[model samples]
Target: MKLPLHERIRSEIETAILSGTLRPGARLPTEHELMQRYDCSRMTVNKALSALAVAGLVDRNKRAGSSVAQPKVHSMVLDIPDLEQEVVRRGQRYRFQLSGREVKQPDPDYPEELQLAGNSDLLRLEGVHFADDRPLACERRLISLAAVPDIAAQMFDKISPGAWLLEHVPWTEAETRIAAVAADRTIAARLELPIGSACLSIERRTWRGADGITLVHQHFVGTAYDLVARFGPAKGSTGAEPQQL
Candidate 1:
């Protein structure tokens, strides 16, 4: 099936932005220029640009034209979810069972900086979060053994690593990223979803003082969870208010 003309235009620009061809702060083509390039009407070009602006991928300026948006630094200071507590609050039984654990020394193949593997061993863990005997999320976590040596000895029989870390460790800084993805064979099997099923992925990292503590990536069925981030603009930035749909 062929996409609409406006959709095709949007996809082209979107691919450029994601592929780093159109970098952040880079000026995009003018509305008139896009109309000429796509051989579409001004309304079609405007529609494509409007959609990109709504997705936080571009900043539109009527007089100066459009440009790629800078990445957001603030995450609204919202409460990060501990799946166990979240499930229980929903009046359901919460359980976390570890399926795999290993102490790994990460190489350059991975994002070494975030893994905190330069001088420390990373305790890699794979697990699933359950609610009332149903799979809720799949997790892959890496704990810096150097930052929290005690985590090496703690056997997570009845508690999850995330919950345990939250209780025992104090973080000075943290970051979170949310993305949509299609479930692959591994994630599909773990979440009991069909291949290509839409999924939501949350990746987070925390640091204690100057040292990195842990990094975790979790995947949830798209229909099973809602991530609401209600935040205003940062103190000095002219960015728009952010909301997750």
Candidate 2:
């Protein structure tokens, strides 16, 4: 479906923000400039700018115009176990501290970006994933108790939901994507990092066969860790091992 004019503009602006093209405090073009660039009406431009303003991306003043918002540096990651384990195997012990957890009704104002629809009852887990006793990642996860009944009684301070699920529940499918973002005040405080620090964010959805999606895990990793992927030919084939960045 085609997005509304305002939404399209909002998405374009968001892309620019996420990609580092829009640095904080960099003034954006005047309303006329944006209208001409987007070939849309002034209302469309206003709506886009308003949406960005709500997201804390830019500051619009009567004479100052719009400027590139400071990029928040939150870490992004994917649920690739090998990489997570490798970080710990390198003599760095990984630990997770439970920041908060509860079951709540989905917020009506929740952004569609989460893709969590019609989910009134969700088990939420918020925590920080650490390496060598230092902050490594901050995570907020939503688990469907109806799908994973035992989750309500499980211990999470020790084993992560992702790891625990991998052991007890065999997942048949999953999808994930990574994005870089600047840390907001809330996340910055929990991760004990400076506001506007860069961090990697991961969004993942897991499914156990045809039983529908089981859980959605979100991660905000520190800038230190890198997410890497490897691929190869058949076992008998001759090829060099993938290089690590």
Candidate 3:
């Protein structure tokens, strides 16, 4: 489906900001300039800018014009325990099955957030994580071969891609997005849930410096697990509460 004129304009600018073409505090084009460039009216341009401001992506001032907002960084520590260990800790037998693995080029449909260059092979893996022989999560991952060439030769039958990457690769940074989504036919079957069941979906991307390392999406049965993160001050620390993002 085609985006409305204002939304298309918003998306283009958002893409530039996300792709680092428009760095923090960089001034966006004047409203008149955007109007001319997008062949739209001033109202349309203002609407797009308004949406960006509401999204916390840009700062707008009547006299100073609009500029990209400084990206806020939050320190969130999540317990990404190994699935096998987690199940064992709960006194349940743990098992995993590597359902599929292949080396292939990323298709056009690949997410733009990964910022991968064209014409590079990616190692795709699909599997199911189980506890007490009951499926708990469905895993889909894409590993950049350019970043970790040795990954293509490893057989993942005995180890998960996430575990192997954590052991072998040194990542400088990671980002995660979490949401609740309804299970489709494929995910429902893999996680042994009814179709349209509520599931917790997590998309994580790890990076080594400026290079992309891996992107993985894991879907867990919502009723089977609860995602938890702890937040507090360090020992002997005198500081204000961390700012919300």
Candidate 4:
């Protein structure tokens, strides 16, 4: 189905911004220029830019015209579900235990995904979560000290890292990636599963504005639990239909 002319224009510019074709602080084409390029009316161009500004993807001003905005925190609603609630919903008792905690500088060999310099300090946490006395998942997390200054002082053994971060930090954006892998010896022992057993792995990273907040890797016993997400269009909008995963 064809989108409205204004919506098509809006999507084109948004794609450029998100894809790094139009970087932060890059000036957008003037309304007159866009009208001429797309052969659309000025009102149509205005509508597209207005929508981008409202969405926090662009800045608009009479003096400076339009420019790509600083990266706002992007979030996926599927990332913040409570594991304890999920366990209870399945009629199992939930338990969490912290195995280790430390504060250290980022290693030079650290992966690029964390977006940190070698000198930056991080708070590292290792733990396991259980259902009915059986291990359900193993968690390893690293929190940026610059993003959450007091993170090292928190008692994550009493409150889970996820819960503590949700309560204390204001994240602007998050990303989650899910995959499957065979359990290695370390993970097998932690989750109380057989070596080479299939497992579900989730890698999640979150940020507050442009500052990296935390990165977590969770390995769940595959056969005992499933991950799910549901989505639907907003009210009064002719958007995509409801779907589940």
Per-residue lDDT of candidate 1, residues 122-221 (tens digit): 8999999887777788999999988777888878989999999867665535777889999999999999899999989889988643568888999988
lDDT of 1 at 241: 16
What tens digits encode model 4's per-residue C-alpha lDDT throughout 1-245? 35689978987887787556888899999999999999999999999998778767889999889999975442224446677767776777777899989887776676743474224688888999888888888999988886676676778666788878866565546678889999999999998888999988889888644668889999988887676665433111112111111
RMSD, model 4, all Cα superposed?
12.9
Best by TM-score: 4
For lDDT, the strongest prediction is: 1
User: TM-score per candidate, in order?
Assistant: 0.62, 0.56, 0.61, 0.64
Lowest summed lDDT across 10 adjacent residues in model 2 is found at: 234-243
Stretches of model 3 off by over 4 angstroms after superposition:
1-79, 111-114, 117-119, 232-245
* lDDT values, one for every candidate: 0.77, 0.64, 0.75, 0.76
- Where does the lowest 10-residue lDDT sum fall in candidate 3? 235-244
What TM-score does structure 2 among the candidates reach? 0.56
lDDT of 2 by residue, 159-213 (tens): 8776776565544345676788888898788778889888777777775433333
Regions of candidate 1 where Cα sits further than 4 Å from its true position: 1-76, 113-115, 230-245
lDDT of 3 by residue, 57-121 (tens): 78999999999987555333333446666667677776779999888777767564236433478
